[model samples]
Target: MLENGKLQRSLGLWAIVGLGLGYMTPTVMFDTFGIVSKQTNGMVPLAYIIALIVMLFTAISYGKMVRIFPSAGSAYTYTKETMGNYTGFIVGWASLLDYLLLPLVNALIIRLYLESLFPSVPPWIWVVSYVAFVTTINVLSMNSTSNLNGFLVIFSILLIISFIIFASIQLYQGMGTGTLFTMQPIINSNVDMVGVLTGATVLCFSFVGFDAITMYTEEAIDKNTVPKAIFLTVFIGGGIFFTASFFTQTLFPDLSVFQVVDDTLPEIGLYVGGKVFQVFLIAGAFAATTASGLASHSSVSRLLFVMGRNNMLPKKVFGYVHPKFHTPAINVVLVGLVSLFAIGPSLELITAIINFGALIAFTFVNISVIAYFAVGQKRYKTGKDIFSFIIMPLLGAGSTGFLWYFLHADAFIGGIIWLIVGIIYMLYLTRFFRRKLGTLDFDEREDTRAVEADVKVSSQG
Candidate 1:
């Protein structure tokens, strides 16, 4: 329950990490391995390595912002406070696509995996069921969702470990590739830089939730824990993705051999562990996807809550916090309602669109860091400060901007249309920039300050 009309202060380092991993969903490697293998010419692990490096710069920028401004409003808060309210609103509008479409995509993927396992069940039933389940958990409370997320993440990790062990045994027995460790997956004869980079852009989607831990800055028991958790999530999630894809690719080195690329992992399960293990794979996929959907739902609702409270959106609907649960009850339900559109299922095109929003927000996050510290405050005292505040953010902006440059044409066009819609809406909000509305006001609400103090106390004890 709320101590005084504020969201509960209940999460810590591990819980935040769990939520991040749940959002990233290590099973993403399983779902898209075929495409990554095709694009990278079997060097899927190399693609992930490159993606991880690109994500770290942006992650560091997010960590800095969280330390300076620990609020529920993530990129929106950082951009608006430093770059003016208009820029922040645009960045937030771009990020809304990332936050909103994530759960819908997860729900659609969950329906696909379930239908593959049980052909008798209708698709819409699964989508509604998953949406309702995720929304209910989110509405109950933050701790409730975090605890469940931790448990599911543990199970997902164990399942991947099992795959590695079984695959090792098969290699030892002279099956499939006849060797456990081979450079074939990383150093294929058909290696090309263009294919590898395109694959890297696609795999970058796997790292979407690394910044999500910052959304919980207000709720984290120790404010310092948020940054560490972000790094841990990236490295740990990267490690799992790298390991799982390495073994799977080693077992099936040639992409041309498979009839359906998407069915690669399920077939590997059958080969190594029989029909029962295939069933297990299906179950594990569902659990991982559902866990991701739950985390995505939480992040999106929190984003809406912050925007609603700022009067950027309707405060009554988006800003209403449940007195009993201390959660954004109405926003949670609204996200679930929006996720119903996933009933038809369009994975590749929608995924590209989601990545466009993420890249835009990530690029601006780096810019905001530079603008706030280097230009606004002029506080470059030490070598560490100079590198952290200036050099790092510049590299981050360049890296994400490069990715945005190479985004699929369809995705770029769709994102531009979305931005145009947001621009028109911003005109309505600002009265065509005539009123100079939405000027930044840094006052913390009394209840929010109370929750922050309580969280600090909890951390100290």
Candidate 2:
């Protein structure tokens, strides 16, 4: 039964981790491997390794924040409580782009994959069908959505593992690269920093899902569970990316051999496992995309719900939860409506624009950690605090700052325009700074000593 008409704390560690992995979509590494290989001179694993290192730091930073403030607002709450309301609003606005575009990107990719499999079907059909289905699942129940996500994620991982096995067999049997061991995928004489950084920026999309875990803080069974799940999600997702891309690169080391960049993995499937495996691979991609879409839908609705509950948006519309379903039905519908925009743009443009918002949010999230732990509380007792609170987050901010600086010009412009619009709207909402900001029900600070004690006991035991 629902308690006090709030989001039910139904998600345990595994379910939350499953939702995060599903959101990241392990199959995406295959979809973009060819492009990354070309940019890095076939050093896909090395670029992924670099991206993973940077992402891990941000993941730790996020884990710290979730421990401090377990709420659905995520980066917004962290920045607001630590930095200031104005700064938090800006971070929240940037996060809006990340959460909202994720589903759009997944929905668009679903249509693109379906088109590749069946060229005659209209693209809008797949987009509409996916959006409606995912939106409905989200509106009904988070538990139902999580169960569906868990099943799909397991299936997708199994398919990728199958491909790895087949690829390894082919390598041993003198196919494609004709050897199991090679260093070309990690380094080469033609290695260029610019290309590696560019590819790393693109590959960052695959790491996007881990941060979404924080959006479910209000719905988690245990506040401590969210932080552990966040770290695990990033570690597991990064492992899949590194392993799958390594084997794929080992099998298809020559980028020029690809007939089409996006279709590279499917083509390699045909070569190693023949037509049947190609069909299965396409099926796997479809499953992965669906799961990712569902995860994204769930994440964005919770974000809108938190913003609405805070009166940041129209609370009457975005904040309303269903009496029985315990979901933000209006916000769910709104996400489905906005997802229609995916039909107007190319995949490259949409994905590039997404990176801009995500990188900005990441930079601020890392900064928020420093502000909260090191500056605000001066929390430096535990040995882990020095590495996690001080050194690691600083590196995360610096690395993400570099990526933000080098974002594609189009993405930079789009992000700036979006930020400008947000500033104008916020001004109106606050009545030109004359009115104070509204707070959510769970906005009050918790007893840090008690919370930290609980977290420490949870981890130690």
Candidate 3:
């Protein structure tokens, strides 16, 4: 039940919280607001409402899944159980791309922000320095990882809250250009439904990492708290805060600002907050992205470890957890190397690939719940089952599919390539399962007992 030398349950839960908000804040403003600006024009708040509605359905699905099957390999576990092993491999493999690439991009953002604070330093230098520090922190153990994440999360939240509070004050004084609160910014006359959906698909990327609570299920104390933690983690992302932020567009009523400049939304805070508040925004963004980056590294490496243990992948690297650190030492090191190499790639291209994989995995997770419901009916289904299994999964999958259509060609191509690569690995493993994979790390006796208990209970019911 416990990983060696972990930081205990509370820190694990707190880390989940940090990872959720940290991952959300840095990219949320930068990624989504422009499209919202474009469609709704000045009514950006409406787009946030739309996104929240979409995410709420999925977040609830995640909450239900965490309660039913709490584990680090969330999408992987459910899919493998219902759809079979190979599908699970795809989900696990794709999740690695999502986890690693996003964080690496965030770290690059951190490096860029450093240029403003310390103009003398080279961006690459800052990148390397930040990577080294974060890698060291991760290698130390989950205790340190969670602790550092906690600090960063708190610091980043304060920084963001400062921006929001300051901007809200400006509105109160009637000094800003846009509305104090505008429904107008939420609609776009120019972009069609398809365009808005396309924009929303990519924008939803910022809303991820809330389910990271599932990653710590092994480390968490009292597993029942997981569903609560997962729900809470994503709850902050709803309409209110974003609606408040959308009001900031009132300060710049021209609507031309988004096209006139790149990355326009956060500037709302910077302009309204003044120079001191601007610094806070930059600091917050960096902390958020970095925290998310490290979390991605930590998370995906565990997936690698899990895959190796379960014979889904060649276990060579993942099986080699550090005796001293209780971390995926090699994978952690490899993640650092890969992230260092990955920074300069196109964001849209990378995000599309991430979404492709995540969407498929998301689809599978929904389907798995449905499968459980189907099997549950043939085998002991409850009346509430349809809500949890069929309707939610279908809704989530349908919503995701709507957005999936808007993905870029490169992301589609990249995901296809990744899938091909996983298929080849899987093919090799299937032909030579014993030779290709390493032994699972958990105690076989305990795992078997647990699995048997579930099957037995199901049979009895």
* Residues 355-442, model 3: lDDT tens digits: 7766776666666766765665453366666566677778877876777777778888898888788778877877845453333343
lDDT, candidates in the order shown: 0.84, 0.84, 0.64
Instruction: Identify the candidate with maximal TM-score.
Output: 1
Error of 3 at 389 (Å): 1.8
- Determine the C-alpha RMSD for candidate 3 after optimal superposition of all C-alphas: 5.9
Candidate number with the higher TM-score (1 or 3): 1
Query: Order of candidates by lDDT, top first?
Result: 2, 1, 3
TM-score for all models, in order of appearance: 0.94, 0.93, 0.85
Q: Give the TM-score of candidate 1.
A: 0.94
Off by over 4 Å in 1: 1-4, 380-382, 437-449, 452-461
Q: What is the C-alpha lDDT profile of model 2 across 401-432, one tens digit per residue?
A: 88776578888888889899999989998999
lDDT of 3 at 161: 63
Model 2 pairs in collision: none
> Which pairs in model 1 have colliding backbones?
none
The 10-residue segment of model 1 with minimum total lDDT is 435-444
